[model samples]
Target: MTMQASEKTPRQKRGIAKTVAFVVILMTVFVAGFFYKILQPRVMNAVELRANGAIVFDNPRIIEAFELSDHRGEAFTLENFKGKWSLVFFGFTHCPDICPITLAKLAQVYPKLESDIAKQTQVIMVSVDPARDTQEKLAAYVPYFHQDFIGVSGDFLQTMQLTQNLNVAFRKVVQGDDYTVDHSGNIVVINPNGHYHAFIKPPFELARLLTVYQSMVQSF
Candidate 1:
């Protein structure tokens, strides 16, 4: 009977050890998957960093080319904007709130530009949702912000290519068979040579942006 009990003790120990090993493996897999799900978007964002600096335009992507048209029936290429500073914003005219707010603040900064500086600084608005923001609508909307502001758009293929090159992430969200574009809320500044100038991320401080604009204009 003592020998039988000894054999039973080994069997019980082996069963308990196997159970603990299985639980550990399950927990490790669960934790690894949880971490992956939490960090995926951040990893993708790291791959899309654009220019960042206080005075100069930080490193901007120069890898892609775009062909688009302006609101007033003029052909606007990346080439046409050469030799002037452009405050290029990406949004549709149909954007009811945020777009107008940004433009209004930009308007506040507009007249402050000195004449020589003003001529060099062109306010440009590019629509990420081109299917809806037509030339006429854009023409009307742009002037409400600043009389001289220019609005531009193109077909989906061309728009996507340009936005991607600029590192602007946008998605067309579909619901009940209709769709709306979910896009980033930031402005890109293109320099006189048609290279990137800088970017202004929002919650914008009007005083700071105006100051930055003045400095950049002086540099140009």
Candidate 2:
């Protein structure tokens, strides 16, 4: 009996040691993942194309220049809005969800941008649905968000050329007589030089957006 008890004692100790080691490993793994999540800055989700590094500023591929007419049938070239800031957004007024949300956010951020910079920051919304979004429709829909927001529309070919150059992807989808569009949700910043500057993805936080915009424009 004494020999048997002595043997069992070491076996019990070994079992307990293994359990403790396994638990320690699990805890270490859990801790490492938690810290990695928390320590990482700028969580990007459900947003449009986000430019990394210098693409956001200092340097960007300037997709060739083009000319189009505004909602009021006013002719405009890239040279027109120079020497001022412009926030270019591509989406149509017919869009039921993301387009309105994004434009509304821009409306909110617009005043802040004006107050801080005092430069003429034009908000231009280029409609992907030019077939439906006419100049009259544009004039009516655009100003509803912000009076200063400008609406641009052109022939399908002209709009397509501009969109292709800017790298904005859009498609029309129809279901049960209802038509919808899936479009890129990138809100791009154009510098005074009319160059492709930075882009803001969706799910934008007001504060972070403000900070990023301030940093972006100041660098120009």
Candidate 3:
């Protein structure tokens, strides 16, 4: 009886050890899954941004100080870009199709932003054709799309200063008896630090734009 009891005692101890090990593994898996569930949305946002044609810079570019005038005739400098997010588009009021369409799309997206984001965001139209896009012209045009939209224009050299640094290209093409300005259609995103963070390309979709903008802002 003593020999049988000794063998049973050893078997019971081994069974309890196995059960403890299993419990520990189960607890570990549960903790891991809990954390993953919490982190999954952020990971998916980055993926969605890429899928939506947003080009996020690994290292954001610094914007140099350039003086310009807003539609309200206020001085708009690098400081104006500070402390808030700026969505900048380079176009003229005279643009036949692209400018109006793009601005309308932005207008549609602006009101849909979360209140926090809307408060921190500003939509700006920087005139690529400064010769014809005086402050008054911009004032009348930009606000037609959204009441809060800002129109910016300055001397050609000053405009070039901002555009070249931001990698925006614009040129005048002489048509019969007139000229048209051809410019890049991408929307430039400036971070709260007044740095060039990313650009969202053309063929913009309202949902995709909202997603990309929100993801970038929230991640920042």
Candidate 4:
């Protein structure tokens, strides 16, 4: 009987320890879940921003001074990007598919934006094929989609200055003595401070783009 009681006491201590461990683990999960619920709105907002193609940067990149000419022959410099938000696309007039489609979708999206946002925002298309896409060509091409949309182009070096800083990639491809400019289709967003803020990935959906853009501007 003495031996049996000693064994039972050990078993009881083991049982108590197991209960204490289970209680600690259960409380840890419960505390974690309570904090998660409290933070859900901010967490979900960030997730929704990414899901909608609004890839915001943790730190905005500063844009250096670069010189290019706008469709109106005005000096389009880094200063042009200040004082308002700019949506910039890199493509050429000869882009047979993506450029035109993206510009058309932007045209549709622009007018539907809230009045305050539309007033403060500007749309710009920078030519990747400066050798073939002249100011006259851009002037005629860019405004066809939207009158307010600005087209920018310059010498190869000047174009490179902006494209390199923005991380926009482009190259000239030759086919049968003619050439085409292959370029990225992502739309770059510049904040009012002339800093690189975010980018929207291509195959852009009009509704999603509008929603995401509005959310970014409002949040800023």
Candidate 5:
């Protein structure tokens, strides 16, 4: 009877181990299903955010670390784009035509946006010609279009870090006494996560911009 009882004890222990393993597998499946159900809607929304004409990246490109000073002399970094949608343009304060025209068009769209939208969206002009576009000059030039507009300038290498990441091109076209930077005329959209989201090409229309921007923000 002692031998039989000892043999039964080992079988009972094996049965308990099997039950525990089964329970763990069941729990893992249940937890995975719960999370999948919770995340399905968000995954769908991201997919629906895709625009037709705008060049939005499928695999969002992460921006590198860069530090610059805003027109107000406040430090600006990759952190500034966090929790805020940003429209960035790389142009000089001394840009003859393209910069002013682009900024003017942007100004037209600024006030027309809903107060909530305006608060969440920021327009930044990053100077390609940092030598001449000082913080003082940026403060004067940026606000001329809109009071809320921001202008940033710092070391050329730091500025280039951002420009290159965004694929914005700019080169100095030196003439005898004056030089102008020939830059790409496209506005880059940065998502609240500080990732490169989209690029809007030139001849921007106010109504079209507002429509697309609102859609992008909502979907994002």
Candidate 6:
């Protein structure tokens, strides 16, 4: 017999092609799944959406004009807040519980920001009790919490220019030859454009704060 030919018919040829195609598709799917598993945690683990105390503004409110003094007695203004992100708190230096504790919490979270974000970020404590929170006093108080942190105070109207627009409230309470300030503990977030961006209400949780902060910055 002249070498009986072993040629696949149309049906046989089609069957072989189908088997090869199936194997190739399975391999492609397996490789894609493997990569997805490897990358999912790194890409998805971070807080990509706003959560915790974060309140994102659809339209960032334009900051009102004001002049204030920083800890070193330098001029601080809405213009100064431009070109960076600011986390501003309104409290007196003598606040018994909230002021120092909140600043300390901020200090903890401040360093955790990505370097790019950190470079564009600032922490400011605006003394509602400007009577006692002189620039010198602020100098001593603010840097004690974080060396880079700023303390600012001004005349009532100047301060009000900021606090009123931001909706931070305060009042003086006197008791037994001493006084304390009753003020809003919420922190205001100012965007790089020096606009009111959001509010963070206390009591703060650091991890949650960081997540929301990072998400906000990244999105912006």
Single out the weakest 10-residue window by summed lDDT for candidate 6. Answer: 40-49
Q: Over all chains combined, what TM-score does candidate 3 have?
A: 0.80
Encode model 6's per-residue lDDT on 1-220: one tens digit a residue: 3532366577877888999999999999999999988853222122333346566778989878889999998999888889999999998888889999999999999998878889999999999998899988999999999999999999887887788889889888998899898999888999989899888778788877776777777777
Model 2, span 118-143: residue lDDT tens: 45678899988988998899999999
lDDT of 4: 0.90
Query: Best by lDDT, which number?
Result: 3
Give the alpha-carbon lDDT of every model.
0.75, 0.76, 0.92, 0.90, 0.85, 0.85
For candidate 5, write residues 1-220 as lDDT tens digits: 3556456687788997899999999999999999988853222233333443356677778999899999999999999988999999889888889999999999998887767878899999999999999999999999999998999999999988889999998888989988878899988999989999988777687766766666667666
Q: Of the candidates shown, which would achieve the greatest TM-score relative to the real structure?
A: 3
Extract clashing residue pairs from model 6: none
State in Å the error of residue 140, model 6. 0.6
Candidate number with the higher TM-score (3 or 5)? 3
Total backbone clashes of model 3? 0
Task: List candidate 6 stretches off by more than 4 Å.
Answer: 1-51
lDDT string, candidate 3, 1-220, tens digits? 3656456687788997899999999999999999988854342265667778898888999999999999999999999999999999999999999999999999999998888999999999999999999888999999999999999999999999999999999999999999999899999999999999999998989977887888899888
Model 1's alpha-carbon lDDT is 0.75
TM-score of 6: 0.78
Candidate 1 displacement at residue 181 in angstroms: 2.0
- List pairs with backbone clashes in candidate 5: none
**Model 2, position 178: C-alpha lDDT score:** 77
Off by over 4 Å in 1: 1-55, 58-63, 175-177
TM-score of 5: 0.75
Ranking by TM-score: 3, 4, 6, 5, 2, 1
User: What are the runs in model 5 whose C-alpha is more than 4 Å off?
Assistant: 1-53
**Residue 24, candidate 3: C-alpha displacement in angstroms:** 29
Per-candidate clashes come to 0, 1, 0, 0, 0, 0
Cα deviation in Å at residue 24, candidate 4?
52
